[model samples]
Target chain A: MNRMSSENNLDKPKEDEIVRIDFAFRKELAEKVEGNLASFCYQCGACVGDCPATFYSDDFNPREIMLKVLYGLEKELIGEDSVLWLCTNCYNCTERCPQDVKPVEVIISLKNMLADRGIVPKTVSRIIDTFEKTGRTVQLSSAVTKERAKLGLKPLEEIPMDEIHKLLAPAEEDSGK
Target chain B: MNKFAFFPGCMIPARYPHMEYAIRKTLPNLGIELEDLPEASCCPDPIYFKSKDKLSWLSIAARNLCLAEDKGLDIVTNCSGCTATLSEARHLLEDEELRTKVNKRLARIDREYKGEVRVRHIVTVVRDVAGYEAVKESVKCKLEGLKVAIHYGCHLLKPSKIMNVDDPNDPKVMEALITALGATPVRHRNWFLCCGKACQDEDIPANMMRDILSTVRDVEADILCLICPTCFSQFDHGQVRVGKRFGEDFNTPPVYYFQLLALAQGIQYENLGFNRQRIKPKILDKIETTLSHA
Candidate 1:
């Protein structure tokens, strides 16, 4: 539980074992964003019990993700493992955690950090840009428009790109901070 | 009850326009009118957008809610995902610092989050606002013993603190709506599982969906009563793809609860697009049987 000073370096650590500790990021996440709940996680495996996605992959434990945050294993989590995408954001884990460790909220902060570094999955990266372009994850085509006509519904309108760009500018700046 | 805006989100209008048609055609008969939610974006897509940028996700969802606030109408979203996102946004913005941060961003567009309006999923509007009995009375015919397994997709009932949409585990909203249609809402094992709508990797969601669909099979459900468009597609279409991939038979049909409501309220069978469904839903035949019985 002791904070090792030599473990702070980014790449291949000064230690023989890669401890994967980025205490600064951990502090920022715990204090500024998802709260100190990540630090409070005792890894009781309650999150694994609550995760419906666990059936598909054993590695997709919300508790493990919290452990990553606690250990500041950003590379092991966000870089090596694609477990973040596997989280359905179902909230069952966060909702049921006894320590009030909201793994889903903490997971998002992890995703935001990964996204800030442009290290997210291609599809996730694409959709984030897609929303900026069209204000929709999927765009409306003429065929769908005609189908809308058949359904007696009007064409679905999107928020203008300029407005979306303007709205995101401040956050993009803040994410930099 | 008669006037409110609709938040179709992305999925329904994109892949399932007919669901909106069904709701539009049905809700009015139940005394609810849906107006278009002007200049709305993805709810900005709950899982994906929120994951990428939490602050912007909240700001954007709050902005979407502001449109409804300006119109002085509670927003009713068609997709559970949108309902979850908007609801979470509404809850998060209650914090003064978060509201200040989001409002500062919104100010450029001459929009601000006053949090005056509410966001209700269409199911809540039906069961809570329209009242279950009002809907039940509107059903002049029974579904002729068609048994439905209710799938309350994750967003509608999770992070229950932020999303007061339903009780997470003991949700009776969808079942109550299903019972009103004269179909038996079959309770099954894993009734509280997700359809993995947020799992982007097809394999994980496919396998997860297979488990839920298998439960539907185990209970011998005639069809799934689905509210979320993502869940609807996953059950109806994703089942086929996943089943094919896994070499398992996930043949359970998914019917949007709205379609059943519209059908029970006497919308013609051919008009609602049962043919488009992979499992070929027969809510119409059940209706036909009930009409003959009557």
Candidate 2:
């Protein structure tokens, strides 16, 4: 069954079929993340039923990512800028999964694994850098600050950068999986 | 009735201070007190930060929680992402093992998340803390006949067991608030869908937002009513980009739910920050007209 699944994955099973099974990868995810329903997913396809992203773009499929994780397609899951980034983390999949497959957490775990390997997307990394440097991922706009003053509200004081940097510095060095 | 440490997160404070003005101005009137969470950082970009470093993400979020815990108040976040990160991080750290690990890392910063704070979204605060009836009674300007298409935004009502904000699939919290303000909460297709904030750091497909805005238009709704600032930006600020990207002309402006509440509570529109928007919602004008008539 394992070898057949691997072959199916190699053939790139269309849609929500079991393309492969990566037992080790599934276990690693289970151990690290909140819940790994990756291996346990029966490919019920119920997740795609309400997935808001799939309704917009065919490329954004939650179940397909689940199949990739089950097939041990680590590279497909995280090694590249794959469809995992398209996850809205809306929890639609996790909510309706009959097998208790909380796919959102698995996707987040895969991201953590990828980030630890330093395969961070430029956008994700830049946001991480911004949060580290200024304590706020997006800076408060001067226009909004000026508007606050116009509204008789005090303008926001700048976030203390040193404290945020100090708090986040420990994990910055840890590339641990 | 209950005090909450205000967790504004990054987006609302930076991109939409008018939300703060409304929240600050309106909550006090309703007898809900909010204090600033000093030394607070971002909810650290809940989705993006997790993709970068889960440990750091949880720790940073936990540290924010600790600040509120020190204040002896549960947190009330105005942004959905902030509420998600802080609430979810607090939820995850409830695990003794995970708490220890995150705290061991937090030891470097001389902070520890004791998991003492209860995280509440701004809507939840309004409904539960302020009492929905108090909201109804406090409405000085009844925005009657305004059709509000609400986007609960994913984080506000997802992962039901964790978020526990409302019924996940069929949410009435935001709808109830809208109705209380004398507006009709029009049920539209995919009204509760994700705003695609997770995917937008790349090419935000115009079709994605196109589907949403088109539905709002189909309903002939006046504006998109929501609480999440990220979703607010994607719908309001990203309106033009989503229009240009998808080549659709979308003029619907996104208003923070609290700002709307402030308006109903009688805060001036100028005080709520509608001026900062790219595409302003028609409800603003309608409310102004209502006020001028009264």
Which model scores highest in DockQ? 1
CAPRI grade, predicted model 1: medium
| Candidate 1 global CA lDDT score | 0.80
Tens digit per residue, CA lDDT, model 2, B1-294: 568888888787677778888888888877898888667878877788777767778888888888888899998988888878887888888888788878777787788778777999888888887888888898899888888988888888888888998888788898899999998888788686678878743453456677889998888888888888888888876788878876777678788888898888877767676865888775587787678678
Report the Cα lDDT for residue A103, model 1. 81
Tens digits of lDDT, candidate 1, A1-177: 234555764354356566667888787665444445687788898888878777678767787778778888766676634678788877888778998878888888877777767777777778777788888887677877888887777777657777777888755435445
Worst 10 residues of 1 chain A by lDDT: A1-10
TM-score of 1: 0.91
Q: Find the 10 residues in a row with the least total lDDT in model 2 chain A.
A: A168-177
lDDT by residue (tens digit), candidate 1, B185-257:
9987867888886776777887778778888899998888888888887787787898788898867888889
What TM-score does chain A reach in every model?
0.77, 0.71
Please tell me which predicted candidate would have the highest lDDT against the true structure: 1
Interface RMSDs of the predictions, in order, are 1.9, 2.5
